[model samples]
Target: MKRFIALIFALSLFPLSAHACGADTDCALGDRTYRIQMPDTAGDKPAALIFAHGYKGSARGTMRNKSLAALAERLGVALVAPDAIMDDWSIPNAPGQSTSPDVDEIAYFDALKEALISKHNIDPDRIVVAGFSAGGMMVWNLLCARPDDYAGFIPIAGTFWAPEPTSCDTPAANIIHIHGTSDTIVPLTGRPIAETHQGDVNKTVAMYIANGGYSASDSPDMTPDLSCESWRSEQEATMTKCLHDGGHSFKADHIKAAWKTLMSGN
Candidate 1:
């Protein structure tokens, strides 16, 4: 009966699936909405990469990156891009215009996960969240505050905000932190802004490692575009840090490299 219905719909020259969103359309949910693009040949329950936009960036802006779209298609994964409430993630202690601290950011991600699984036919266990700069900070906070939510994290050139976290939760999943060695905007050692400070990126990763009890992998390996250091308990989890020789800039290639390194072991 299902096939018959689908055949009838197909014969009508219209796609059976309803309202699929891409670079041009928005997937509205609650008061928020995100944009998504699935690979042309995506398999059943294909993996997804939730790429958060950087500071003051929007979902439409993220979707407009053709390279990112191509990368997702080449990897055969769904690309999910979400927007911040006000051009900035309302993280507590993070510099933003919000008068009230955001408790919705976490909830928003939870909603996104549910939406992906129920609506998109994506693999629940293979969703990896990644971000650049301020969005990268959001990735860290998500992993730190909610360790059990996603399969992995990839944070590029960002870390915690002022009043650095003393600890993060356990059951820490895999992480691939990418950064630029010459970053002065969000330095490795971190820099101060007004009354707040950008927490050291190294310190943030170190805390996760110590808290998660991940052991270093014995042998070292390198990728084509970037140099990386790794730590892992292969039976359970992995944490890797990759660095390039650039400044506080970003490219889809950085996330592509991180995605390769993260999925290689899993």
Candidate 2:
């Protein structure tokens, strides 16, 4: 009996099982699911950087990028990559794509964020959301839907559909939009996505500038293969338009720029 009691006490002290998730897994939230990565410091409630992958892309795929993984570790940020319903994010009223009313992408995001906050003690004010391509459009949609939810945003290679918001629902968060000048998939001048037209990048920037109280001045900044023109609003939201020789892709330099802007609080 004494030996059994000692064994039980030892087992209790070092539990036989651990329930924390691995580097990546499908975490179910009510009727939705998200692919999450809890950092080594997750128990300490580290800041989160949630990423929405491009249309038809998986969260694991994005996490597999060595640079992104290293960035998460280097910055001490918890990385949460949520999978979209129907294999793609449902942007509001976007053509050629599932709409949020049907897929409830917004609800999924809400659930995911709440879960992270409750379970991992995430800092609400430190959360940022970023995306690429179709996912980038969803980032803009998220800003429109829940303007105050995130600390910042990075939308790459995508923009809102026509009739973009002239005003934000809430005060601005830091925003950095990265686009390739040679992107034919979603042109800077905008094009028909499917049945509707995505708005011009300049118009989107203009509206943000007006609403964000930014002066209409762009300064030059050069990257390895891209020339960038950057503008900042009084609210600290920034727009960095990069003219790259490539198309419809997120480069390592773009990630670096986005991270720099995010860390700088602009």
Number of the top-ranking candidate, with TM-score as the measure = 1
List runs of model 2 lying over 4 Å from the truth: 1-22, 41-43, 216-226
- Residue by residue across 74-191, what tens digits does model 1's lDDT show? 8989999988878778776876553146357989999999999998898998888998888888888888877777778988899889677888877877888888999999999889
For every model shown, what is its TM-score relative to the native structure? 0.87, 0.82
Candidate 1 similarity to native, TM-score = 0.87
Per-residue CA lDDT of candidate 2, range 1-266, in tens?
99999988887885221343434656666766666666776556688888888878887787787777777776778778878767677765577646646576777788888988997688887888888888788888887677678877878888887877777665665677788888888889888766888778888877876776766445434457767666676665665666677789886566666666666654
Error of 1 at 203 (Å): 1.1
List candidate 1 segments past 4 Å from native: 1-20, 96-99, 219-222
Candidate 1 overall Cα lDDT vs. reference?
A: 0.82
Q: Give residue 19's error in model 2 in angstroms.
A: 4.0
